[model samples]
Target chain A: MHNDIASLINSSVPGANASVVNPPEDGAGDSSVLVDSSKIYEVCEFLKTNDKFPFPVLQVISGVDYVEYFEVCYMLASFNLENSYQLILKTQLKDRENPELQSVVPVWAAANYQERECYDMIGVRFKDHPDHRRILCPDDWEGFPLRKDYEVQKVYRGMEVNPEAKMNFEDREFEVRKKEMEADLLKRQLERGH
Target chain B: MQTWDMGIKELQDETQDESMNTELLTVNMGPQHPATHGVLRVEIKTDSEIVAQAIPHIGYLHRCMEKHCESIDYRGIIPFVDRMDYLAAMNQELVYSMAVEKMLGTEVPRRAQVIRMIVSELQRIASHLMAFGTYALDLGAFSPFLYAFDEREKILRFFEEISGARLLYNYFWIGGVWNDMTNAHVSYIKDFLDNFEGELEKYDTLVSSNKIFLERVNNVGVLSVEDCFNYGATGPVLRGSGYKWDLRKVEPYLLYDEVKFDVPVGTGERGSTIGDCYNRYIVRMKEMEESVKIIRQCLDMLEPGPVIGKVSKVIKLPKGEIFYRQECPRGELGIHIVSTGEKTPYRVKVKSPCFTHVSMLPFMAPGQMVADFVATIGSIDIVLGEVDR
Candidate 1:
């Protein structure tokens, strides 16, 4: 797969290198790919158009923000080749006010909503989206909720957002954990067929 | 309880873009319409019968599952995930669990993989049943809807026996499943398969090959293969457009690589030139048969073994990040988990296919009749829960 990808990239595009990023074994290629964000569109175009990998399908596009930088991943699948490939394009949206990224809508029409969502949640703005509006949230909604720094919400659109919204982790706290344990004990007591 | 008449008129006025003198008719199809499986309001702008634009106004059923996912225990979040794409509950759970498993580096048991295959295919049949039923309803054919429901009920009954709930069953666990498949479950599934082929023929006669249904759907809302790819269409929607990109076959997760099943793709001028509502419907109807074939192979391979792999009850995953995805009935349902070597995931991101699927609406909905827009939407099969989540 590595040789095929490298040869494919080398043949299709100039100065394109597709090294094997075996992260689990080496963990070196895990954090970042040695590829330019600007080159993503070109590579994608090549993948979709060229003979090597006519990956006509952009299956899923998602993002993960790690405080300092954001990791925007694109999973591309090929219909003709019958193979799947992941293109993790790294982009840093430094400022929260206007986090902008190049829109892949031109590359894959399916990207309009995924980009809008990345905008709505992580606040990454796609520069050339046809209708880049607040999708999940109301039009005038305040901040991107998915970012690590932003507060979840105490109030959203005048509704009282959960007061414990900020520190609301999925796991139970000690007090609630104790109560659940007690409830389980009581249930077990009631279930005894004496 | 606000009436729709005033809303409809105001919607019409807005459709005219007020500034433009052209009288644009605005019509509200749902929020109560039967064709809209749930409370989905489609604000359509039209001149005569031709729809100029269609804007899907959702969030009526928005419980904010993303917020809920953030607040609940990663494991406990499965049931809510199940609710998002209710038709593809098993697939939803599979994607979520795969993310958690990848983050933790916890390998699932082989037995569990077989079980996952079984449930996922079952859910596929059930989800296709929904598409078939809803597509029928869109075409003003109520009988096919009932027929589809009858088959879907059999699958749901099997789910009820296995998971202890029918609609929103969180049967798949993080490392494995809640429980093993019972003998009764297997037997019922086999019986359903035996009767389904005959029933499917009824569907062909009732709706699929019906002249009215084909006339309503064929050459209507045509989405090309490029359009499907660009828009990130998945499942039957993508397949219906002549792209044979099934995640089960391409990605080969679980025991799918071992399984023998065909990715039945749409063909001909209707499939090529007119990848329309009927194409998607026909593709899904054919997909149900493929799913049935996959399920039979999975069931035959099924044997008694420990369903859950060896993992601590309080799972403290390694500090790592992994993105896991599955070919959900909707599209590629992905779950990205960033672990901090704690019981809870540091950050969990769900990439719902419906989110991307609905995004294509603004692109697909123009120039078709308002009724055809409903049919196209139904053909695409967007679950609002998954869309909003």
Candidate 2:
């Protein structure tokens, strides 16, 4: 669906590199335009100022860890559906060790807390981000929770975040889980009037 | 007593001298303060009565919801979503369900759609009532709080009857609601809507249009339309900035396209700035009325039919990303779903309105009186659960 808008971004903005992230025939859900990580800031500026279709609002900014690469999604929308309603710009950062991307906060101030949150959850650093500190997590938090390989630390400041202490339950985790599954199946059957 | 009088006299003398500089004080207003509405803490820099800057500190209630959603299957996410904005949990569930339904490309049954619209609008009224009640409390009027919640309790009673929970109703599902509405649910809503206007007009005469309330909030903590959009403020915050934009009208998700309702906006009436605390509060007040109208229309259109579409228990969504936005009671609640053809979502990014609304406090809090700070926060009607989530 975004194939048209992705091609439009390529032709309109000078030196703008953009492509559809997941075209419908090949992928699931709606498609979004993936812009070059380095030039994402400039592309956002263009989208904000472009006369033909001004996406005045940066609706939200989110991050997705694809294991191999970290992808950031910038959701943009025009006020009142002026020309085009929405255009999602995504940037992929292949650097797994220390992922960094330019900040679009300069274009949309809405990107301020959202980008910080993306960093807090996904660990993707935004260059030129004002006060780029952790938004939702503590400053000393170790690993990004949203990452695929994320593991809970044994202790958070000496208090066990992953508690070793266990309650005296009638059953272990999988045992209780099995019972819950059976109950759910029976409930579904009853709801179906079987 | 003499020493205390000398201290007060010195303060009065300092006020008399225009040349005398007041000492700047740094005040931390609640990671626990009652007027803050929740556990939200704002670090305010003030000189005498005027605020110089405010930096809001959040994450006290962070449950790492997005992180948790990665492992949970599609259906289980609803209960978790309901907890995010507990005040407007139906709105939260509705938006999340809509996002998943969009990804699955499933059509919600017509009856299900009507009931969803009914609950969403009813939840809107309930949410605005809380906003009105608590905002009145923040502004130092205790009576309206009682009056507002009295009505809100009635809404909650029926909501409890239908959804089986009072505060966090996980009633809405992906393609349908959990339970079908009975005649009891319909009559409860109708009775509430019937008496709602008389109560609303009483509130209007009592607090919203009151001279004293206007004096406290009229021109205080104003945000222009440009500042509002730039910071991504939505719902009453955006509409109160004199923007007539509502997602139900513009985007028209669910049965919003079929419904007839007017989007209430702030017009700076009664000697107030376009986007002041007064405008924001009044917009929410007017929206409750519009919600009533929408609910009446939806109730008339209601008919007997199935409430759910044919969807499998464990839906394996295809590999793609979807960003869906809807107008919640607080503002625009957006769900960005990244599926990897699995039973569980790879990534579910929640774009909460309070998160953005709280971010802009620094923009609005400066240059206002120190007392008006709570007024500004209350006007936005932030539920810290959603803010931290």
Instruction: Estimate the TM-score for candidate 2.
Output: 0.92
Instruction: Candidate 1: give the clashing pairs.
Output: A109-B230, A110-B230, A110-B231, A170-B72, A170-B73, B12-B26
Runs of candidate 1 with Cα error greater than 4 angstroms are A1-56, A152-194, B1-22, B269-274
**lDDT for each residue of candidate 1 in B151-186, tens digit (9 for 90 to 100):** 999889888888899988889998899888888888
Query: lDDT tens digits, residues A108-150, model 2?
Result: 8999899899898889999989989998888898998889998
Leading candidate by TM-score: 2
TM-score of model 1 vs. true structure: 0.83
Root mean square deviation (Cα) for candidate 1: 7.2
DockQ of 1: 0.30
Every prediction: chain A TM-score? 0.67, 0.82
